[model samples]
Target: MSEALEILKKYWKHNEFRPLQNEIIDTVLSGKDAFALLPTGGGKSICFQVPAMMQKGICLVVSPLVALMKDQVANLQSRDIKAIALTGGIKSDEMIDLLDNCQFGNYKFLYLSPERLQSEWILERIKNLDINLIAIDEAHCVSQWGHDFRPAYLKISNLKTHFPNVPFLALTASATARVKEDIIKELGLEKPVLYQESFARKNIAYMVFEAEDKLFKIEQILKKNPQPSIIYVRNRKSCLDISSQLQTLGFKATYYHGGLPSREKDKNMSLWMEEKAQVIVATNAFGMGIDKANVKTVIHTQLPENIENYYQEAGRSGRNRDKAFAVLLTSPSDRFQAESQFINTLVDKKFLNLTYNKLNNYFQIAYGEGINETFTFNLNHFCSKYNFPVLKTYKALQFLDRQSIISLSQEFSEKISLQFIIPSKEVVRYISLNPNGEEIILAILRTYPGVYEMDTVFNSALIAKKSNHPEKEVLAILEKLKEKQIIEYRSKNNDASLTFNEIREDERTINRVSKYLEKQNQLKKEQLKSVLDYVKEDSICKSKLILAYFGEKDADECGICSYCITKKRSPKDPDALSKKIIELLQNEDLNSRELQNRTQTSKDTIIFALQALLEKEIIIVKSNNTYTLKS
Candidate 1:
């Protein structure tokens, strides 16, 4: 215990362990398998990391996300602790080198995806290493009922046979009782001690509001909090739109999604992390490895797919133990939209068979012989070629990736190359004719000196920045130049790539995974219903409702949640509220937010009072959307 505390203070510079961390570490130190269920931001990494540092040999960490693996490895390396990660796309020579390093280079931690463990060569190399512990991150992925079920995780238990004496620690942020049981059984933990910290976040004020204008509500929440924030949307378009809107309203805002180039994503993330951007509007793709503790508010503009996702995203707030907010703004149509997005897009067996067959045919793979074959995949191109719906096909591909039938690496990119076919004078004349293309054409010619001789690959983002134009505008200009025959231009959206891990027996492969698919779809439907029920509920405290969903039944009511506040005002007098609103408006015109602040009442009561006044013609909404006494 003293050595563990010393390791924490020496490396992590933290005086004390977060709640339950010390106990979990002690269990592992005593040579026992442990299952730890900590909430998001509960320092789950430390539970395994600190104890691993106190041991003799390296800790083998099996994670699901490549990005998260790299992040943890980098954090460890930053502290002068040697760590290595074996992610995808590594050449054999480099991989052998990395394995040798782990075998003899005194590396303290080795992070790799579960998919990597399936390779016989890598597994054999791992067997020779002095492995002290096995730490499984996101352990719920092994469960059929977990929010993120990855079949690759089921193969992790095979490691126990290789390292029979090593202790295994399974950690997750959220899981149901059923998921917990699945994790324990699937991971083959022998009499594993279970440690579950309470899921209640006392500093976060859970708030749900029904608003006609979600953007308006978001603006009000941000204005009131005025600290670092994240607003989660469902798509990339909304990420751009809302971030732009927030910037227009004088907030330093940025956006992030999987589609953005890695450079731009890092730039935007840096802006938000360094506090240059007060808010970041993003899709679910953000916040996996991000740990900014000062996020004062997390607002969900649309309904999430499940309570697990909602709870995890909401819990990102208040990590610094200050009072923060978790707000969900809903409209009448959100339920329909949520269903259309999540449930409607679910892939069935028939659709999956179609997708799998089309994929094999598109790649020209022969029956029973495409094992270990890799292909450069462009999802939009595939959809266009097969006349398939993009979302459903993507979902099907994701299912295949999760089942380890194929590895889908979604790293968005664009490959651009061009050659000046016509003479240099002709290109100059064309640029003059199209004034908007002048800057970009000149920047490209200057950047790529050999463009006049042969087709040269160019960095479009760099050219766009050099020419003071957006990347889309630069690409459009290049397209126009190609149309005019001044240059031979080619641009390809190389969005992602796929590697087949099984023989090309299309229908048989689909049949083998059909039950998992069906059960998962049913689970998704149930999860969606839970989300809707949670938002529709008004009597139960929001925090309590969330805690109970995760199998915590005895959580006390949080007085700061929207439900508790409304319950406190249940016996309110409409006349009294109306009078307060009237007096506040008489002095000056006030919007609903201002009125609520002045009267210190709930938003529902203010809206009710405002509606009554409007029906009786005692007050009117001005053209500016403010309330005023009728003259």
Candidate 2:
């Protein structure tokens, strides 16, 4: 074994590398661009991580999801690796400190969001830092054709110009043939070695059932599997409602969505991770960074907008190489609803112009006024002031952010407590008045040595844990101190900033951009239609259909799928199936005994043919042994 493989086995406890992991690592280590299309739970992280360990400087991972970056950093720290995520949630001073650490400290990996790429300070720092490899996770986002396209990803290609020697590795769990080409073109990668694994999960049985009552179907599915599962809904409200319904059905369920507070989100996630909750009903926001490997099933209550999203979510199950199920429960109306959503949600040029105008009005800025000036924006208030739907308006602003016309900081509030508000001499006197509070107050003072002298934010929950009190108790104590004018406390919420690139907008340019967005939405609709056709088509093997969609050819039918099984049980000819019995069974429902008497053929032959027809869905079994035509 090579030296790199030895480190991988020693640290990761895996004797051998997964299919494409070793090759990917070798390509990256050799200082060449590589695009790796590994499915979810396929150890995409290890591809960069192992090479990062073997290489000389910090590996910079540009990820789009903040939560996912934090999760990966936490996982790395758990294994005694030095990692940090530079995100907008922290204070500017804190971010500077972290950047300094990455530059000076012996850190192996520095994960950052794509939005951070435009920061002049960050760019300056990167110019000097010894960045060994630049890895872009979810590289599909760089492509306009991808499901989750982000404009800021376009700035990443500039890194290649800045660091000419650094190799770039783009990794994504799901991407189409068009998206793959777009990723390569957008990221400016060389003619890199392309590694795409087969997009087939044999352990996951793909099943779709049409039902009027989806909750009932979910209950039936749970009763059959009764293992760790995820129920995906379309919106945040559905996440809560379905979870409540599941709880009433005697299952321990929790809900997760973007609307929940950070601490609450953490608590709910921990509950599910610890197996204290049997299931999690969530929106698409819940699964990005989740690494649980034993999920027995993944149920989607509605169709996803694209197959890429569907495949990534479904691939979450069966990570342990165990048999799992991926079921989609749909109704006839859902197809139309999804189509309407896709059409209506398109961020065309007119909407973008109107939105840009409204945003300027909100900031009270003229065409040339708002440049480099940063202020927190209230999206809800702006929408209300302009009489636009909040969700649509928010989406429009997101599009603007993508176009680099503005930047949005997702709302995040941080818990903060002041060390002291009174003079140093008055602290002893204030504590003497409240003897019971004096011990706790003094203990906090001693615990956080330099907090009073400097502005540093510490985790309140950690402080409470060390102080031997509930978090609420610590918060209350801080509140009491604040009321007495002995200390100060405050929290910061997530906000948005509008940054203009230029003073004037050309009308024709705006219209052209709008037309392009409309065309993109139309393309997305076609992609979705293809996905739906794949799901409902009964003639093709499910696995073969998916592999073919990703541009792989000559794929064989997966014999384990329902389509293949049904084919195997189908009768060669309905006309030769005990003719007299078929005649008797076609006219009315007849029991086996009655059919045998009328046909004069043995009961076994009649039964066998009937079973074959039933399996082929040509006949329906009516009461006990009675049979009737499917129509």
Q: Among these predicted structures, which one has the highest lDDT?
A: 1
- Scored by TM-score, the top model is 1
For 1-631, candidate 2 gives per-residue lDDT tens digits of: 8877987987788899988999999999999999999988898999999999997799999999888998999988988889999876688889889889998999999999888888888888878888999999999999888888888898999998899889999999988898999999999998788998878787877776666779877887888888889998997667877888899999999989875668989999999989999899989999998989999989999988888888889888889999888888878898888877766676667777888876777777766566666777765446646767655777787766677666666652234635576776788887787776665676677766655553344445555655666767777887888888777666445445556664535354366467557756777888888778876888987777777777777887777665676667654344665465557766788876566546644445667877777787877887686778778
| Candidate 1 lDDT for residue 543 | 93
Model 2: worst 10 consecutive residues (lDDT sum): 410-419
| TM-score of candidate 2 versus the correct structure, residues matched by position | 0.77
What is the TM-score of candidate 1? 0.85
Each prediction's Cα lDDT score? 0.89, 0.79
Q: What would you estimate as the lDDT of candidate 1?
A: 0.89
Consecutive 10-residue window with the lowest summed lDDT within model 1:
409-418
lDDT for model 2? 0.79
The alpha-carbon root-mean-square deviation between model 1 and the true structure, to one decimal in Å, is: 7.2
lDDT of 1 by residue, 275-308 (tens): 9999999999899878889899999999999999
